[model samples]
Target: MQKVDILAIGAHPDDVELGCGGTIAKMIAAGKTVAIVDLTRGELGTRGTDLTRAEEAAKASEILKVSARENLEMKDGFLQNSEEYQLKIVKMIRKYQPTIVFSNAIDDRHPDHAKAHKLVSDACFLAGLPKIETVLDGQPQTAWRPKQIFSYIQWKNITPDFVVDISGFIDKKIEACLAYKTQFYDPGSKEPMTPIATKDFLESLTYRAQDLGRLSGVEFAEGFTTEKLLAFKNFDGIVL
Candidate 1:
């Protein structure tokens, strides 16, 4: 099993990119190992096919410098918080044994986002239970739960419990997001224009980060809601 410092979960390919890519980039640059687990192939998206999304996800993973990226290939837009799905995520949680987990927003424009939030949260707890056994690749996996779980802000501007100052890594985050050429704003894309594919939405990415940064005293930032209250050992953890 490959252990990572952080594990990011998303309902679709670009969810993490749109939400917390800058935070992930910043963590990685600081020498923290990170991995991504996409819950679905995004087969039901209005813009692109599942295969293209997978390819784009790979590109984004590379750009973010994640240690590993996996897709559970779940049914898109119809995600359920069932034991079957929870166990699937539990396997990954046990496989990676990450100290921190980042998941989809609690509430979002997409129903799947909220569903994934609960699913991943449940799985995180279940993964810590030794009674809930999981087998991976002929090996018995041990129970492992992340110390902290956070949900990134997406589509909606739900006030974040905390904001990460990603001032310097914003460009890298945008670059990773644009790698999904068919998903985001593009003038030449003749396929179809969805809510996310519009020009305003792309611009919102920057403006939204800037707005949050303005409130938090930074050039750019990403917002997240924590499932558990955080306790800092000292004042050093606070951003000045």
Candidate 2:
């Protein structure tokens, strides 16, 4: 099994790129192995078909340079926080053995986002339970849990517990996000327009990062929230 420093889980194909692409790119540039697990193929998206979204996701993953990217193939717009789904997530968690997990926002405009958040969070906890038996490829998998789980900011402006300074990686994030050409700001296409396809929404990606950076006194940044209190080893670890 391949171990990863971080695993980012999202409800849809582009959710991770929209939420924490810069962070992932920055981490990978820093020599951290990162993987992506998309819960759905975004079948319900107005503009793109599942096949196209899958292709776009692959392109985005390559742009981000993630170690691996997999889709759970869950039904879109109807995800549930149930054992069946939790077990699936647990399998990936055990397989990748990531130290840190990044999940969808706890609350968002899309119902799947919040559902995914709960599903991943519950799985992370249940994955640590030895009694919760799971098997992968006919082999008994050992229980494994991530050291930390954080939810990235999405659709809504929910307060973030902390933010990462992605000063030089914002461009990479935008590039990865644009890789999903069918989904965002495609004026030349005759496809139906969605909230994300709006030019303003596309611009907001950068402006939002700029806003977060302004508040945090950085050039650019990505924000996330954690249920557990964050600890620092020393005062120097914090950015003033």
Candidate 3:
């Protein structure tokens, strides 16, 4: 059981990359252990098949150098924030025991993304409860909850609570996102095109990061939101 320092949970395969690929890359470069959990195979994505997306996601993970990656095999477009879903999330939270967990935004263009956000956030809190009892293998697992859970902005251009400076990590982020060749812009692909398939959409992703970075006086970055107002122990942790 390898432990992770940061764990990112997404509704689909490419979500994490779109939301915070640069941050993950930066964290990895800073010697932090990061992992990703995709709740669905993105079977419903218009651009690619589940198998293709899974392969693409794997390539993305490799590019990001995530410590571990897994899929919950949840139904795409029909996911519910039910107890069953929460338990499944709990199992992974217990298994990974990360200090921080990043999840989908509270609201997004994709309804599934919002649902996943609620499910993952609720599960993180529930996992800290002793009565909710989820054990791993033969061992009675200790209740483990991430110190903080934040939602990464996606698709909707949400106002982020904070943005991480990922100046040097932007290229790595784009590399990871482009690994989903079947989903992104690829003239070579004979597949159908969608909102995300155009070259301009890809360019928008880069520009979005650049825009966010500029707001914080950085070359590139990723944005995220927190449920609660941020409280730091000291000013030393803040960049500005």
Deviation from native of the Cα of residue 20 in model 1, angstroms: 0.5
Please report the TM-score between candidate 3 and the true structure: 0.96
Tens-digit lDDT string for candidate 3 (11-116):
9999999998999999999999999999999998998899999999999999999999999999999989899999989989988899999999889888999999
TM-score of each predicted structure versus truth: 0.99, 0.98, 0.96
Off by over 4 Å in 1: none
All candidates: CA RMSD (Å): 0.7, 0.8, 1.2
Candidate 2 — worst ten consecutive residues by lDDT sum? 230-239
Q: After superposition, how far is residue 221 of candidate 1 from its true place, in Å?
A: 0.7
Model 1, residue 231: what's the lDDT? 87
lDDT of 1 at 144: 97
lDDT of 3 at 175: 94
Return whichever of 1 and 2 wins on lDDT.
1
User: lDDT of candidate 2 vs native?
Assistant: 0.94
The prediction achieving the highest lDDT against the true structure is: 1
1-240, model 1: which lDDT tens digit per residue? 999999999999999999999999999999999999999999998988999999999999999999999999999999999999999999999999999999999999999999999999999999999999899999999999999999999999899999999999999999999999989999998878899999999999999999999998889989999987788888885678
Candidate 2: which pairs clash?
none
The model with the greater lDDT, 1 or 3, is: 1
* Residue-level error in angstroms, candidate 2, position 89: 0.2
